[model samples]
Target: MPALGIDIGGSSIKLALIDHHAPITIAASDHYNQPSPDQLTAHLARAATRLPIPPDITAIGICLPGIMAPDGIRIERSVNLPALQGTNLPDLIAHVTTSPAPRRIFTDAHAAAFGYWSEHPLPDRLFALSLGTGVGACVLDNGQQLLVTARSSGHFGQIDVGPCDDPQPIGPDGGHNSLEAYIGLPALHARYGSALAGHLTTLTAADPPLRALVRALRIAHAIYRPQHIALLGGLGLQLAPHRDAIKAAVDEHLTCIADPAWSLHTAESSHHAAIGAARLASA
Candidate 1:
């Protein structure tokens, strides 16, 4: 039997149907430019109703942004998407799908981490940082479990970086000052003004600040001390120019710490959350 996986983001939603452990058969794929909560829920329900597969599929999984409680009752605040706060996602999706089999919901970062581990089969102490519009972090401690916390693991973009206090663009009341303010794409654009696009183009040509950014990420990983750090999302894929600098920085930082044995890798797919959700649903 096949399993259905849905990954819901602030900007887009992706769905896939996977049979056994083979390639995913995309039943329906659509991208919403900027979806409202009701619109997103309706879109997912419409897609789920028209799935071109057996009704008795193995399982169904949905991955969402923001922090989800283990009991699945409440969704904590979402930085990118404010409308999702306090939503009962599990019940909402259940109402939408109405399928008899078990349903699962996971944070997008958690799903991506699980998907990466499912493919790589890494050590117990592995973490994944997804650098997209924002930054998220997910960690697997024993390879069989997903850590749940009031503070979502992969929301590392919220971590305070240093003494660079600028008024937050999102809002003054909204909590903002974090590493994301420095490295997230939108924030980078805001800071660099018109030079942002050119900077990315130049990054492809080896920009110095971009290289320094990679080194900073490596330094953060060294402090975390995970056995492996997997960088995911679109920005991570474009880090090839600074790959050597990143590795060197990681090595240099680790040299001071006794018995440090961590390594870094970039994830191969943007659909990792969907893939992982499908795999978890089947499992």
Candidate 2:
């Protein structure tokens, strides 16, 4: 059986057909921009039309960016995808896929962790931090997720790294001189005042985001003490090119704190999210 795994990102929507015979095998996949609420069902309909194979989609697994209703179907509020504020996810997906297939909705962060777990099971303890249009995280302990709710998890963006009298919020609600204000793309955009691609290519060692990320990493390491910490999401993956610099900076900053000695790996943002969803679809 094959399942449809969808990863709903603030900037992009990634979906794939997961082949059970091959486990994480993606039979077919598609990518698109995050659409508005009214356009979602149609977007799903169109994306569904392009599947490599036809309608035997056993179950649909979706990873959402924000809170879900208590019913677990309606998305209450998405910081990045505010358009999905009150959409009924399961019904919308069911209407388009036209199968009584069970749907599983997970926080994008949890999905990332689950997706990583699906691929790499050797490490039972994992902490996945996702930095994208919004910021949050998820943790796995002995294969069980630490945070599962409609609200939000690992609100890393809200962590206050202050100097400003009024900090802007990274989590979506309040505005504070929070970590998101320093590390988020919107913050970079604000600094440059343009929508240029690769504007962050020339980051410096003393850059605020670099400092903030190192600080966050140290705190997460001390708290979770996971065997591995994988970085996910658009900005997080973008840091791959600068791994050496980031690591060096982290080492320099951790003189007082004991080294946790965990390895850092980049999460296959789209692949892991989809694969994890597919695995959960079968569960």
Which predicted model would earn the best lDDT? 2
Cα TM-score per model: 0.76, 0.83
Look at candidate 2 and tell me the lDDT of residue 260.
50
Global Cα lDDT for candidate 1: 0.65
Record all residue pairs in model 2 with backbone atoms less than 3 Å apart, i.e. clashing: 67-150, 167-176, 167-177, 168-176, 168-177, 169-175, 169-176
Residue range 175-282, candidate 2, lDDT tens digits: 566667776656666665564355567765576676677777777766666676777776776777777777676666464444456677775555677677767777
Regions more than 4 Å wrong, model 1: 27-34, 42-53, 68-76, 86-96, 145-155, 163-177, 189-198, 204-223, 253-255, 258-261
Tell how far residue 11 is off in model 2, in angstroms: 1.4
Candidate 2 has its poorest 10 consecutive residues by lDDT at: 163-172
Which lDDT values do the candidates have, in the order given?
Answer: 0.65, 0.67
